[model samples]
Target: MTDTLIKVDLSQSAYDNDMIHNRWHPDIPMVAWVRPGDDFIVECVDWTGGQIKNDDDASDVRDVDLSQVHFLSGPIGVKGAEPGDLLVVDFLDIGAFSDSLWGFNGFFSKKNGGGFLTEHFPEAQKSIWDIKGMFTSSRHIPGVNFAGLIHPGLIGCLPSKEMLNTWNTREAELYNTDPDRVPALATLPYGPTAHMGRMQGDAAKSAAAEGARTVPPREHGGNCDIKDLSRGAKVFFPVYVDGGGLSMGDLHFSQGDGEITFCGAIEMAGWIHLKVSLIKGGMAKYGVKNPIFKPSPITPTYNDYLIFEGISVDEGGKQHYLDVHIAYRQACLNAIEYLKKFGYSGAQAYAILGTAPVQGHISGVVDIPNACATLWLPTEIFEFSIQPGADGPTIFDTKGIDVPLAKDL
Candidate 1:
């Protein structure tokens, strides 16, 4: 297999810069056909396109056209790929829009899909990061800078007809049951956000009511925002359509574990060099139904840290009743209290934890009535000294909050 570098041009429109497809539908025409072993450099527009511009400020966060959230670059078809097979996308290199790239992390808002702690914090916030080589620093939130590992936050193939129907049906049912939760499936844009003419793209004149949204991660892998898909990573997707109508977009300069707060980990416009190959009958072998990828450099050197642990417990005397969300919230609360020691207000700390280089892990879910979650905060990013909390009791110690333990039960 010889390396033939191909460039998929996405920098085309006046607004989008590159001609990119904001929608993903099986009926969408293939932008290009690459033979197996052909390497390509896909130019990805920033997740926002023109909805939010370089000159824009945090106030602009509210005006962002929510409908056009993820602007995907292509439905690049692989010549011989087919459904049920595993399409292997080899990420050779991922970086800035070109030599220079800047990104933003839009804070949680009530109008858009709510944040991890939406009820508590409803106001919007935006932080801009200047990307230089491997480093990222923001002036808004002074004192922290970290190496940026670039990767496509959203990448996947077109879903089969059956799969698409399943997606729509399940989504409809979910919305039908709870109108409030409907926002999860689709958040109406704050203003006029979508430029791609309605009923005109891949979903145009097709069986689908509209293009399948590029929000949720599906069998056809749309916004799976998992970090570590940097250089030398193998992303495998379960092909659902002929030629494995592959698409990629929503490149993130860097991201934390849950991307729990904002539109997600420092959203940016960039290019990812990909080389795709096929794994015939890989579905049967792996018994996996969706996209799965082996991230390179499996373990990362996450420098420094404060660890906050939380276990899910309910009111009264309860043990084996576990709520993962409660456990996660507990971890967040612990981290927030810890951040207070460093001079950050609770709300400030909440947004920072959501946007910063923090990592959250499910330490233990099998521990009977208590599922544990741990949040790891990297110390190196702080401009100030990393210090332990005071000798007295901490928030977790006196808590009747997010954490799951029933102390005086």
Candidate 2:
């Protein structure tokens, strides 16, 4: 039989709900599983279900009940998918409703209150801004890639009853804060120092009042907005509940790393096509929780590590370069150690890793005190083996030192 493509109609009232607060109910029809080579397309509704039109403005955005903004479709069942299996969602394509561009002051703008720059530009605010016309040309370049790419910012299945409630409460508290104070308050580090203590207390009280919604990351994945979860990317999610309780929202058009705005790209309408497959008998082994990871295979090599500094630039153009270089170096070191656990010799690991290690800058500066950098080894380096013990670790062996190739899930 030809693989079937499931069409989920978001236009139905049963699927309509507030984007921010709704969770995928198991009752929604789910897409079934197919073999590795099977293919299909799934239709999705705009985050607003077309209720908010193309011409809607800042007033429309402001008046939106925070809960009902980002509606998504599906919890499509993958037939034969059990609790321990992994749902491999291959994103084949994504298309937006139309080419019309739109932009508004984001959650970080002064008026909306709360961003890394709030302290520096205490008065910088925009009530009704248009980002459609802004464009820049490079000195050596001849053209501009119209900035737009849609992907969800928050996508994952709910963890547990308590965790979902906590996430909801936190979001509510964040929404109720004075737009001005929100930015600063949200960025404050949790601690016992006077300022941190006070902020934590207030946040705690706010969360409690808002019904204690929380989202914690664990073996059962919660809110991980890894930007790579886009078209052409394959995400392997472990099933927790019987139907997996899959849900996705927080649409972004284009966003830099670190999603400094705590928001991403354009929040608009689009549909994502996914194919679900079962990874039989794969569960959290080695105490590993959250059975999700980018499936890009990396080869081992030894070479000088590339490094980049992550810095936040203020509206006044001030630059805050945190010790990003140190962070980058440490991350590389950590990778080496992690590989050692897999049983590869230090020299072999370093040599294989050095083949191509690129340093990446995560936009931590966009939000104060949330700095991050990444070191990555290219997936092309690993040579895949066929016979199990012929040469290298088994594909399933993500542990051990001195080798490469992640086991196919």
lDDT of 1 by residue, 147-231 (tens): 7667788889888767766777777777667676623644322223443322354445453344566777887778888787888
Model 1 worst lDDT run, 10 consecutive residues: 400-409
Q: Candidate 2 residues 227-249, lDDT tens each?
A: 45666666777775565655565
Q: Candidate 2 has what TM-score?
A: 0.50
How much does each candidate deviate from the true structure in C-alpha RMSD? 6.9, 17.2
**Model 2 error, position 392 (Å):** 55
Give TM per candidate: 0.84, 0.50
The prediction achieving the highest lDDT against the true structure is 1
TM-score winner among the candidates? 1
lDDT of 1 at 301: 62
Q: What is the C-alpha lDDT of each candidate?
A: 0.68, 0.40
Q: How many residue pairs clash in all the candidates, one count each?
A: 9, 48
Model 2 poorest 10 in a row by lDDT = 189-198
